[model samples]
Target: MQLVLEKRAERSGTIALVSPLLAIGLTIVTMVILFAILGKNPLLALHAYFIAPLTDGYSLQEIAVKATPLVMIAIGLSLCYLANAWNIGAEGQFLIGAVAGSWIAVRTQGTDAGAWVLPAMLVLAAAAGALYALIPAICKVKFGASEILTSLMLVYVADLFLDYLVRGPWRDPHGFNFPTTAEFDPVATVPLLIEGGRLHLGSIIALLVVAAAAILLARTIKGFEIRVVGAAPRAARFGGFNANQLIILTFAVSGALAGLAGIIEVAGPVGHLQPGISPGYGFTAIIVAFLGRLNPVGILIAGLFLALTFIGGEQAQIAMKIPLDVTKVFQGILLFYVLACDSLILYRFKLVSSNRQVPRGAG
Candidate 1:
């Protein structure tokens, strides 16, 4: 019995360490099967979805563009997750941030504010995101509301709000009735990092945020408090950590980071606030956060990997005739498998010994 228990514990530890790798492998295998079912060569499809995009410089830059928002959002989300706060309204926060940033850009279009405009827009965006996120946090803390439902429902509300504004008051008269704002002045745009390249300063911001988050989580007193609160709320209270303050702080920080991502995306790649500006970067960042184990450094790698999937998925659709929906399907499979694998870390399966006498027989 002792031997069996020891072996089980060892196996559990091994599974804990290998779960993410296993999930990734399983995702690949599942995709291969899916492609085969769709009458495509599994190997070729896999190559198109995962490998072909990395071979060229343009695609490499595209990866950075795709990753920028994801990395930013994931960095903030890592903090929320660490503090045991579930701020699921990042999508809403992101949208509000974009609107806030765009408002500044739209108002300053005719001005010569130059470099200051972009920084001001980013600040407004971050503030807007934090303010938007605070509602759900406050609701949860004060009224005992379910944040998951509240935050998620707020996303559509914010999106619809933007839709209304762009189609009405904020509509550009020179846009010929298009549901987008006027083109932002060149000075309001995020400057390109490399000459003749789409790579912008946002990627640098993401890296810096990652480094800062790592240091904060690894070295700060607040970081220790967050960990303690997450692991044991009762213990945290015993240690004089205020749960309410932590919740507000976590949500605010997460929202601000997500908002910064929205600002960068609009000011850098998208270049204008359109009806459908985001391609669900906020939602995808959740997957990135989990895949990275909610660690800032891990999130950096996971963000790039997921970004590769986005670029490669687009390429596969154009080149291999794969359906665009396949990308979402693959992501779903990866998330499912990753969660399932993580379960093994906490639970074990045992085979009953048929030859063993039942205790009830003796009793």
Candidate 2:
């Protein structure tokens, strides 16, 4: 007996739309089992994870703040994925952006830099991110190196570089020996949407990014090229689209967006660059990208849902003594289910039996 997945003649659009929801449902069921195994009340844990975070105004605001970066980074990642450019190092690009932006912030810590300061930081961060992402793109184009491995490996390098900067030269001299820079000046900070509230301009920027991405994918020739290159590369080439150029372009754009997200997180929320500025936002954006079906609008909704989990994880830890790692487990399970469910869109499983002659040695 043998089992195999057979390709379908046509992909089911219905399944494509429902796949993410199916994955979410499966993830929830798995979480319930996990909670039971951990000796916790499954219903209560579920309530805390989903309902509790939504009921509070403060938690709702915090969720928006968290989603800002996720949506921004995911939007960029969606482009890369669409163009068949595997960029696994958004985390590194993020760190590099924060570090690059902070250079301006650090230098002007106590000085009177003009309004141009914040804009310069943003531009520099985006540029740095693009340049950093180009390393893998160029390597893949020129040397036939795998972008996935090179990009992922560079993440550690960027991480270590950021760590060294904060612990060494970027550290605040007057303050105690903490691995952080001085608080950014007001001119460098992102303006808040509401007085004394966590909501900031970054959220608005994320919304704009979503809208822009929607337009790009739907209305632009470049967008069509990216889609063709990813979906049918040989055909795209026949149509006069250069795959290598698209790869470079997508990587640069993705890196720029991720870098923008990084600087926004530091300037808008943290007010300083530190070691743990990101609580894995770059990595979590991967889930956001897929869960949204790589659509801008979908990514927005998905980002908010994932942001709720971050808040829920904190509440679960504080109220139920649940391990924070459970949230990560939930994400991992969700991703697995997502990939598994998506296979059903284009494939079906079959069981087959071979003739006895195949096992003549046993006879």
Per-residue lDDT tens digits of candidate 1, residues 1-363? 221211244447678678888999999999999999999999988889889989999999999999999999988988888888888888889999999998989998888777789999999999999999888989989998987888889899989999998899888889999998888899889999998898999999999999999998899999889889997999999999988888899899989998889888989998988877887888888888888878898899889998999998999999889998898888778878888887777666566556676577554
Candidate 2 — which residues are off by over 4 angstroms? Answer: 1-3, 351-363
TM-score of each: 0.93, 0.96
Q: Indicate the residue-level lDDT of 93 in model 2.
A: 94
Give the poorly placed runs of model 1, Cα more than 4 Å off: 1-16, 353-363
Model 1, residue 42: C-alpha shift (Å) = 1.2
For residue 202, model 1's alpha carbon misses the true position, in angstroms, by: 0.5
Among residues 3 or more apart in sequence or in different chains, the pairs in candidate 1 whose N, CA or C atoms overlap within 3 Å are none
In model 1, the worst 10-residue window by lDDT is: 1-10
Per-residue CA lDDT of model 2 for 221-336, tens digit only, reads 99999999999999998999999999899999989999999999999999998899998888999999988988899999999999999999999999999999999899889888
Provide C-alpha RMSD values for all models, in order: 3.3, 2.1
Pairs of residues clashing in candidate 2: none
Q: Report lDDT (Cα) of residue 63, candidate 2.
A: 97
Whole-model Cα lDDT of every candidate shown, in order: 0.88, 0.93
